[model samples]
Target: MQPCVLTSTGGAPVAARFHAPPGAVRGAVVIGGAMGVKQDYYAHFAQWLSEQGYLVASFDYRGMGDSQRGSLRRLRADLFDWTDDFDTVIAEALARSGGAPLYLIGHSLGAQLPGLLKHRDRVDGLLSVAAGSGYWRDNAPQLRRMVLYFWHVLVPVATRLFGYFPGRKLRKVGDLPAGVVMQWRRWCMNPRYHVGAEGAPVREKFEAARFPVVALSITDDELMTERGTQVLVDCYANAPRRVERIAPADVQARRIGHFGFFRDQFQSSLWQRALTQLQAFRSPGETRDPADGISSRVAPGLLTAH
Candidate 1:
């Protein structure tokens, strides 16, 4: 793995790890999960993709992981900053790989950010794991949503006064900024805000650059709900998209939720499946390990527009 850096539109420096095939590269970029997520968690998957003939680039968004630091905290970052960081990473990946066709594998919130990047046309395809369209659906219950909203309102004040919120100690909730939290809430409550790459707002000119897309969701994901996943599917403006659901019992190694898909004991299984699907699109006849293939049960299908 080679370490590298790139500058975001915000002027923040980004850090990334690149894995190249021994021969000429196929193409792919593997993005880690949200806030404070480390690429080591997906290290095995990175190496595996490389071995399968892909030049995979994995990175830390600015203000997170090995990237250079700025004045922001995770919970404090808004969507715009994240989008800029993603574009920087993609640009770096293009430069390093000699500007080959690029496929993207984005996990959780990271999945959404890539689609939001200004130059998404550079992408040849997308694989989104545990994708969320930014809303909770009915799972949060009206009362709980209100309480969470109120808590989000206080997060900024509390962090400012106390220097930080409790971090990730809150059960099942991610460590995030009050501003990001509120922005997400606003998107979720409004009928407009889309989740994952499906929800990100794109410029009209870039809308025609539809590449093949695969969205996989796990059953019983506490952080991402089926309803939310369905909503995301409904909003996608792309053709030839697939959405697959994985049951916990089928999750080979560890029972994965939102974060666990890339971190669980059975990560190898998930990677194998996803890699197979990705490789299937590389050329007309490239084949990858089915063990690396996404579950047959959770396979993505043709995505219909609403």
Candidate 2:
């Protein structure tokens, strides 16, 4: 892995790492992370993809992880700002791909922001893992009470007193910029999440997105539920998509939670499934839409162990 720094359109410095394969590269991929999660958390997965012969890149958004160079109290960033970061990373990936297909592997919040990308159409395909709308009501029943406390109580109190959400101290996700936390809170409080929060402009962008997408929803995820995942899939109205609701048993595992799918332990199982989807983009004569058909409904039996 090689360290790299990218500058967003707004001039914020974004820290990133690039992994190149030993042999000829098949394609280029940019791994988009969940909110508050650092890019280093994905280093192992990026390396694994590199070993698979793809040039992979992972980056940290400004005010988070290695990108945060100054005081958190003075930092200001929102969802759109992070999207600009992704754009920069995507542009870099495309430039280095030598005309190979460029793909996105977005996790959670990472997956949701691609609709806002100015170059969304240039992407060959997208792989969304545990991606969903963050409306508290749409979350898992086991997490709804905590979600309510987070949005109604914790976020307001923390951001007001600290100028940022003290998520690290609170043991909730990770530390987040005040603007990002507040804007996300506004979206989660609404049933429509980002689509409802940002309104018509974002919705129109989602409608215009024509890239093929594979959304993987974990059955045992304590954060995002089936409805949450579907809400995000529904936003891409014009895109051909396949929704896979994967159970731990499918991979012969006991539990694969929202974050477990990316862990090294599931490399042979869940991670390989993601690679299959990425490889599909490079398959000979493959069209944007799959030859079979596209369905938004959950395909529980589609994925099997290698």
Candidate 3:
């Protein structure tokens, strides 16, 4: 893993980690981190992809993780600015890919924002995990009530008082910048999610993104609901896409929630499920560990869409 700095459109230094393949590069992959999740969290996964022959890059958003310089309250970046930062990484991946296919592996918020990026055209494919619309009403049944309490009370009160959301201390979505939290709260409150919240300009961008997409929505994911996933994927009206709904039982796991797909246990199961889908478009070396002797449990004809 090589550490480097990515200069954001706003000129902030966003720290990044690059993993180079041991042999030939199969492709270049840029990981888009979820809301408030540090880039370091994706370290193992990125390295694993590199070993599978893809050049991978993972980085922090300007106001979070290693990129968060100075006081959070003083930092004036929003979700849109994060889009620009993600674009820099995407552009870099494309440049270094040497004409190999480029894919965006986005998780949750990372999945939702790719269409908004300036370099959306550079992406060869999008592989979204636990991707969904975050409108509180469409949240998973278990999260609906709690998210309401968060949006109606906690978000307004906390952001107003602290000038930024102290999510790290509160243990919600991790520490988030004021603009990010405020704007996200607005989206969560709106029925159409970012589409309705941001109006037609944003809607047009989603409509304009033309690529093949595959979204893996976990049935047991506590935060992302089926309806939310459908609505979010449907926004990419022009893309050829698939939404595969997988249950914990389907993968022989007791529980695979919103964040569990990245845990090391899924490397032969969920991780291979992802790589298999991408490999359909680009030729990648076999990454399975025969020692584990585990093949992909995501059987064919498991609720895929064209």
Candidate 3 residues 1-306, lDDT tens each?
989898987688888888999987777889999998998889888988899999999999998889989888888988899898989888787667666667789999999999898877766678999989999889988788688789889988998888899997888998888999999999988888998999999999998987667888999889998889988888887776788899999889999999998889989998888788767743234233324422212222332444
**Positional deviation of residue 169's Cα in model 2 after best superposition, in angstroms:** 0.9
Per-residue lDDT, model 2, residue 1, is: 86
Q: How large is the C-alpha RMSD of every model relative to the true structure?
A: 6.2, 5.2, 6.3
Worst ten in a row by lDDT for model 1: 291-300
Q: After superposition, how far is residue 128 of candidate 2 from its true place, in Å?
A: 0.6
lDDT tens readout by residue for model 2, 134-161: 9999999989867787888899999999
**Candidates 1 and 3: which is better by lDDT?**
3
Best prediction by TM-score: 2
Candidate 3: C-alpha RMSD to true structure equals: 6.3
| Candidate 3 lDDT | 0.83
lDDT of 1 by residue, 32-111 (tens): 45544666767777877888887877776655667636444533465677677777767777766655567778887676
Estimate the TM-score of every prediction. 0.77, 0.92, 0.91
Query: Relative to the unseen true structure, what is the Cα RMSD of model 2?
Result: 5.2
Clashes of each: 12, 0, 0
